[model samples]
Target chain A: MKKISKASLSKSFWRWWYGNLTCFTHEHMQTFGYMWSMLPIIQELYPTKEEQAEKLRTYYPFFNTEPQIGCIVVGITAGLEEARANGAEGIDDEMINGIRAGLMGPLAGIGDSLIVGTYIPVLLGIALGLSEGGSVLGPIFYIIVWNITSIWFQKFIYDKGYELGGNAVEMIVGEQAMAFRESIIVLGRIIVGAMAGSWVSINTSVILTYGLDPETGDKIPVFLQEKLDGAFPGVLTMVFVLLCWWLMSKKKVSPVKVMLLMVILAFVGVLIGFFDPGLSY
Target chain B: MSISWLQAGLLGFMSVLAASTPAALGTTVGNYTLNRPLVASLFVGLILGDVPGAITIAIPMQIIYIALVTPGGTVAADLRAVSYIGIPLAYVTCVSQGLDLAGAEAQGIAGALGALVGTVGTVMFYGTAMMNLFWQHYGWARLDKGDFNVLTKVEVFLPIVTHIVISFIPVTILVYYGAGAVENFKSALPMEAWYMKALFTLGSLLPAVGIAILLKSVINKTTDLIYFVGGFALAKSLGLSLLAATAIGGMFAFVNFQIAMASYKGASSGADDEEDI
Candidate 1:
């Protein structure tokens, strides 16, 4: 009987890393990719083509997860395959699939929030700032920062899952996950708020002309933007962003609808001489 | 300058690669950078021989989709098409019209076209998703035949081939003809008219929508309001740049995390003491 060696485990790891995304479909999601990744392990362990085909059949069930952080599932399953190859009792296909089904959802949430919700925005915010001056450093900085973190974290979790096996899932689903999630969510909120203040550009040059000065025979110009800024700098930008947020979150307005409303508002505002693109600071 | 046959073909091929990045190939670059309009625009600009012009068009377009997230394989607007197709079309239009890259008029064109192409991208995204179903069936058929060896083909090559065909055709046709079509449409229409000004106004306001989306995703609780407001006020009141504001925000987040950790530790320890007793 062939044993599942470190070489074969690494092969499976590379397969999952590369093939996880390739077979994405509306139906079955990442099932095909999962099966493909299991090929090396199944081929080495089962020996007979028929046994291998039977084992591969179990991977066809719907399986999807956040691929980057989801490497743990693959690593855990590799351990399971190793056990089954050694004729360990009670290590059946159902146990493997059940573990996969249970862990995918929670891991997906953690991965998505951490990587998508927090990391990308924070990095991109910095990159956008760097590139505002048209420096090539922005993209380069973003690429290096994102990849180094992603690759390092992915490998660490993958190896942990292998060492701890199926039981390691408790670490992801327990109180620790909630704390990490809440902290990232809070950080994301603050960063986005700062982004809104700095990035949501709304400036106006709408000066109200009323009443002539008796001494100078000159029209008195009262700048509305000045009063708004005096009340609060970037007040208009905040108001506009909040209005957009309200329209999207509370009002249940679709994004496309919100987009249309903004366009219409712009048109009307410009037509009425309230907003001039040229005057936007 | 008119886009030559060679440039158009090369760009079309590049578009396929761009569309395929997030899923089919180059997942690292695709998800990390190329999926962004700003980065994709730079590549398109470089390929088309106009880097600065492309970046100028890409910044506003980037803001429009800044908070874009494709949670659970569901996408509201597809940025791949927007990045590769929309930005290029906007750049081509600006050049043909002699509009200054930094001018409001050019920005207006980019935004309007970006929105239009972004919506079209939704269709393309669905099209690829739908096409992916065929290869899945092929995989099942291979499994039935007990052909585990060719599973790699079903997983990798099939999707790649399908995506290339779907992306290449539309991208080439659009860029090759879309440029002249926009130029003609621009010449015929009075872009200096009031309505066009309205469109430009709308373009300037689109970032608000993007920011709102960001806020909606990040704000999960009412108490989270302090951080949000504090961050905004920090930048607004002190005139800090985004990088500085992000640093300050990072400090706040770190403090918040420590507090959360402490409270969690206290609660868990209290529970442990009770159990011991």
Candidate 2:
């Protein structure tokens, strides 16, 4: 066999072994290929192919190529530290792919729930403003909030995962995700409850309007507000929570049916004036 | 013969459609499943001229997907949003829907329709593609060896072909229908004479239900529940903004994570020690 030069070996390796020749389905080419492709690029910069490859292996699942973010950059930092300690040998491509593959899924799940799920909704809703001024800030607010939160988490998690690779999940699950979930669920429960309360309070108030007092035309103090308060503070919200519980938990209603029913209801409500936030038909 | 750019492009997108269907998940037919929306958007962007539009569409599509949990033979979250929003948005924004078709309401409508059928088409195409198992078995029988590459080729062909074909039908039908139905809805008069306030009041409850669904996964323990109540109470008394409350809650979660992780680790290690002994 011909001896492979470092420069020529790199080129030949990429073209021959890595020509995007997806061993897996080409559909996942973007994901899988992206993680593997970084090896030659990194190796070219440093002679430590085996070393860098080992670092990158812990995060393969994050190998999305569309906008091209998230790879073994952090892991390489970890592996480099390993090399420095040992006066070490290099890393390989396979090990990098392995590391990347492992961390990407769980991190994506956490990131998806936090940044995309809870934060975006609450932030966007608040940003929508209290009036009809058509503020352009709504979209802008969400965009900025989302990007900042996402970027911070992505970078933070990658480093956190790599630096503590042996105990990354434990560190994350304990220090971050657990806390993240705690905050999320707690606030989520309350907002959900308040929304429910607001729904009922806004909807079912019994009016006790009496004609202005006969002589002075002054409204007499009646216990109407008190009566309404005593009767029901959060009837609709209660009904809503129970309904969701019943559908999703007890009766085990399917989500699709619920979505379909809600969609139909929303359209009907829009037509009938039942859904407006400030006013009603 | 070398494949021309347009032809190659057309083939690429068509392959995406075939591969992206839900039914494709079960079949060894095609490998077009790249987390649907992002992949679809990329396809449309490259085909047309607006990668930004596709990305914009992908965000909501992702949110909508959060509610989509398919456990044990079920469907959740309509994966059709890409076609519904992406296609129309692409056409409206001209993801090669044609410059002459610029702002063509029909193109927008078509894209929406394409998304709808494209989604369904993904299912049907993959279901048919499942026949590939038999094809593979037959090839193995004949040659004593088989190529997994057949699945790859079929996968590539399906989505790209499906997208192109499905897209045209919707665009055509939407154009044929004109905006007559939507126009009629727009012109239809509201019943201005009724108890409008009451009706609107009831409508406000809609969001509460959505929130309930979203909040389902948030509460794990009783302590978290207490914090939620505390945050809400603070918001009410001190008039703290909801955003402020959420941030506060997040801080509580951080503390909770530390406690929970330590406890879990201690328990696990104890169990391991017990096993060892």
Who wins the DockQ comparison? 1
Q: What is the per-residue lDDT of model 1 for residues A1-281, given as tens digits with 9 covering 90 to 100?
A: 44677777777777777777666677877777778878888888887888888888778789888788888898888777777878878888799899999999887776666676567777877777666645666666777888788778777777778777776777777665666667767767777777777767787769966768999999888888878989988888888988988887788787768887987888778878888766221
What TM-score, to 2 decimal places, does chain A of model 2 have?
Answer: 0.51
Q: Model 2 over residues B1-277: C-alpha lDDT tens digits?
A: 1223453344333343323322222111122123334334444445545444544433333223322222221334334434333343434433222233323232223332332333453353334334333433342243223232333343333333334444334433442232223333212412232333223332333334344455444554435445434544545444566566666756665666667766756767745432100
- Interface DockQ of each model: 0.49, 0.13
Q: Taking the tens digit of each residue's C-alpha lDDT, what string does model 1 give over B41-64? A: 768778888777787788778877
- Candidate 2's displacement at residue A175, Å, is 6.7
- After superposing candidate 2, which stretches have Cα over 4 Å from the reference? A1-109, A130-132, A159-167, A174-188, A191-234, A260-281, B1-178, B186-206, B221-240, B247-277
Cα misplacement distance, residue B2 of candidate 2 (Å): 44
TM-score of 1: 0.89
> In candidate 2, what are the lDDT values of residues A1-281, reduced to their tens digit?
12223453334233212212222232333333333333443444445645445433432343422110222234333433344334444434455455545555554444334443355455544643321132334434544565566445444544453455444545444433454455555556665443333222323333455557889998865534445445554434455545654566445576545544545654465556444333211
TM per candidate: 0.89, 0.49
lDDT of each: 0.74, 0.39
